[model samples]
Target: MAEAFTIRYIQPLWFIWVIIAVYIVFYAVFNHTEINVGAYWFAVITIAYILISAFVNPRDEMYASIIGMPLGILWAMYERKIDSYFEIGFLRKEIVAIVAFVILFIGRLTLSVVGFDNQLFQSVLRNIITIAFIVPLIELLKKVKIQKRFLIWLGTISYEIYIIHPFILYFFEKETTEGKQVGNLEIVLWTIGLTLLLSSVLQIVQDNLVRKVKL
Candidate 1:
């Protein structure tokens, strides 16, 4: 929020100082309140940014591009409250998820073929894909008795898997491809195995660092 607003006041040194002074006053005033002072600051600042961007800023295009991100953040924060709202249709949820993904894949291919990059069109399509796939998948998982925490743990290391996967694949390409012929299925299994192993190691290292910080 501050970053979005900073460009306007960057050149005026006094204005920047005034913002700092206001923050100091805000903290001092809120220090006696019941809620965490930081949460108040965050909510105030985020709302300020959204209002200014939507009403004050003349660039509707920029606002259009950025509004989805904050809405997504808000949705995630209140996801548990709205889990039941995603129940969509008569079709089985897993089948619906698969069909949504296949349609999304075809849409992407069509985009590539036609080279479509209209911002508004892509933004609408992105939200449609999220609604078509993720919302249904959540409902389906509930119906199938899948543990939600399983997804939570995987989400934790998803970034690590992405980071370490390329190195793992490179090693497999170097070692396995030269020594012997391997099927695509074998290569995929090997990649997943090594990626999981390395991601777990990375998580362990982070846990240790966090523990040390607390100590």
Candidate 2:
């Protein structure tokens, strides 16, 4: 069980760590610098990495996500300024973003249904669509009033949910491989429930450990 869990989780763990480390270093260097060369350098590096990965290991989708790191940094740095501009009342930036997101999402689905199998193009398109969806969605969410304790709890555990849900999915898929026919809805529900439970437990354990260390 330990070996199986390790095998299933190691790559994702490593990938997340690498992303975090890269983002930290990138942010540190550019955050205080007068001349922001981070984006330029990141673009160059990302292009090179993509080209090499495409030629050498075309099967790897990791490079596609890595390319978005610099963009994330850029967005973070300018997000407040962008948000202020979008808040101008008449521009309706959120509505525009939502429309674009829906159009792109539908277009992607239509293309897929029609047998569009260009991985690189699809990956790029998906990234763009995600950014379009998320930016405005986040802006809109900022105005939402959360009165439910469960939703508040879910928000607190969201990161852990993201990290642990893949393992849950993998475990269920493995069970299916061993002859258990788990339906899609069952898998989704199980993944969510298990993720929330595990993350909450882990968070409590971490808090206790921190208190013990401080003591």
Candidate 3:
């Protein structure tokens, strides 16, 4: 809902790079204190999710109940012209974007140093950082193409995928070794195959249901 707005806008590589730089600045707030990069990454995934979860929208850290529901209603109320919000002169200002980036960067850096190394404190701090930068990130992402097909497909079934994917993963893991590492590429392919198959069927069923209700 937030990101559907900037698709046709000009997004230079530098623009994308600047956004990456912003995210890094925001991220480094928690990270620069730690000298080891590998340990830093290990900490990000300390939540016991599968490796693919970090990159998959169905498994993204953000949730529909938390993020999707309100946005869904808002997108409806706006009649899907939510992208036009970017047309505001203040929001489109380069200086506004830069200030947003720097404030986010400095705030996080300050938090990182002041908060020290407490994990719970850092988690709360990161959420604060997200509050500072999420607007700019969404502003930047709509113009950028991370994975066009995946984004479109996920956008279409964004709510459903979150619910369906867990079940797919549960069954796939259940039928397999369950506890051991899945080292086979074929097994990974099978997971992909199953997700596509099941998700397509679900989408079809959902479309039929929506059509019946005229929604």
Among the numbered candidates, top lDDT falls to 2
Top-TM-score candidate index: 2
Ranking by TM-score: 2, 3, 1
Q: Write the per-residue lDDT of candidate 3 for residues 1-215, one digit (tens) a residue.
A: 22354533222122233233333432443344442442334334332222233345443233212222223224444633545666566355535766876786687678778856444444445554454455556656676777778778766775455445555565556656457666568666776677667777777876764444312
What TM-score would every model get versus the actual structure?
0.41, 0.64, 0.42
Residue 100's lDDT within candidate 3 is 72
Stretch of 10 with least lDDT, candidate 3? 63-72
Better of 1 and 3 by TM-score: 3
Residue 143 displacement in candidate 2 (angstroms): 2.0
Off by over 4 Å in 3: 1-67, 79-81, 88-155, 177-183, 212-215
> How many clashes does each candidate structure show, in the order listed?
0, 0, 0
Q: Rate the local accuracy (lDDT) of all candidates.
A: 0.58, 0.69, 0.48
Off by over 4 Å in 1: 1-72, 87-112, 115-131, 147-159, 174-190, 204-215
Candidate 1 weakest lDDT stretch, 10 residues: 9-18
In candidate 1, list every pair of residues with a backbone clash.
Answer: none
lDDT of 1 by residue, 1-215 (tens): 44456744333233233334443444444454433443455456544654665566443433343334434444655677656444555366457577877799689668957989654456556656765666666666667754688677787798567557766666666676588777789989988888988898987875664343211
